[model samples]
Target: MNQRRQKKLSHHLFEAILTGDARSTKALLHRGASPERRNGDGTTPLYLASVQGEAEIARLLMEAGASPDIESSGPGSDGTPLCAAACWGHTETVRQLLAHGADPNLREDQGTGRTPLEWADGGPHPDTAEVLRAAGAQPSPHRAVGAM
Candidate 1:
């Protein structure tokens, strides 16, 4: 596909992910849209899906070769899919990412510097915190408050 078309598909895939539109996301991926394509701030489709707690969409992107540990490039984009899911209290999404080999100990952006477990603990999701703990995730030393 041409660069223009691919760019369009990339944007569409991002939108589909944001809206939790699994069908559109699948179609875009089928058409060769990269699951790892990023927005201006370097957010991938998988990351967005995790943030939105769209497990099915995340699964589709992962199946299409989305890297669970792919960190964004821009400033404040140092978060992985697992980090996003954990921060948002998305237990199922966190589970899915973890099953797909997401790094439970991965830290977020510089300011936060929090691991998935720390994010979960800081949030209102005990279930997600338990999941992270079960995955062997530890909190960053700097943000150790409320860590499980």
Candidate 2:
């Protein structure tokens, strides 16, 4: 496929994942869609799925060999799939990512100097802090959660 067509398909797949349309994601995957194709924000389908708390989509992507630990590249480097899931309080997605070897303590120094845990703490998800702590995330003084 041409790059433009692939990019369009990737964007469509991302929208499917975000909308929690598991069937659409699966259909796209079966059509040879890439799980790791990143968007303008450097977020892949897995990352968008995690951020939107789409567990089923995330699972399908992971089954297709999506890397949960794929760090943001180029302009955006502060979030991973694990970070997105944790920040959004997607417990099942986070668990799946961790089981697939997503780094809990993955920190990006994209001027924010914030770890995944710090970003999670800043989000409204209550259990994210606990999850981060359980995953060996160190406390950042800037984060309001104050070390679990």
Candidate 3:
């Protein structure tokens, strides 16, 4: 497919994921919408799904070969899919990403920021923090949530 058409489909796929419409995401994937595509804001499809706590859509994206650790590329991007899910207390999404091989300790902010464990620990999700710990994530001395 052409790049333009692919971009359009990816946009729609992102919308579907954000809206929690698994049927639409699956249809778009069948229509060649790429799970690996980045949004105009430079966030990966899986990142959007993770931030929204859309575990089903996240699973679909992973099945379509979306990388669990693909960081957002746009200016002010939020880092990896793991970061988004952990910071937001999306427990199931975090679990899905980790099961799919997302690095438990990936960080943004040029590596000075919190790891996924820190994000989870600093947020309302102590449960998420435990999950990261079980996956071998080291604790951050900073606990910097940063209003994210």
TM of each candidate vs. truth: 0.89, 0.77, 0.89
The residue pairs found clashing in candidate 1 are: none
Model 3 CA lDDT for position 112: 62
Instruction: Give per-residue CA lDDT, model 2, range 26-139, as digits (tens).
Output: 999888788888888776788778878888888899898898877656354346778778777888888778777777777654435556677677786668768767877777
Residues 52-130 of candidate 1: C-alpha lDDT, one tens digit per residue? 8999998999999998988766455457788889888999999889888988887766435667887788886899999
lDDT of 3 by residue, 21-87 (tens): 9999999999999998888778788888998999999999999989998777766556888888898
| Per-model lDDT | 0.84, 0.76, 0.86
Return the top candidate by lDDT. Answer: 3
lDDT of 2 at 42: 72
In model 2, pairs of residues that clash are: none
Which residues of candidate 1, in runs, are more than 4 Å off? 73-78, 110-112, 140-142, 146-148
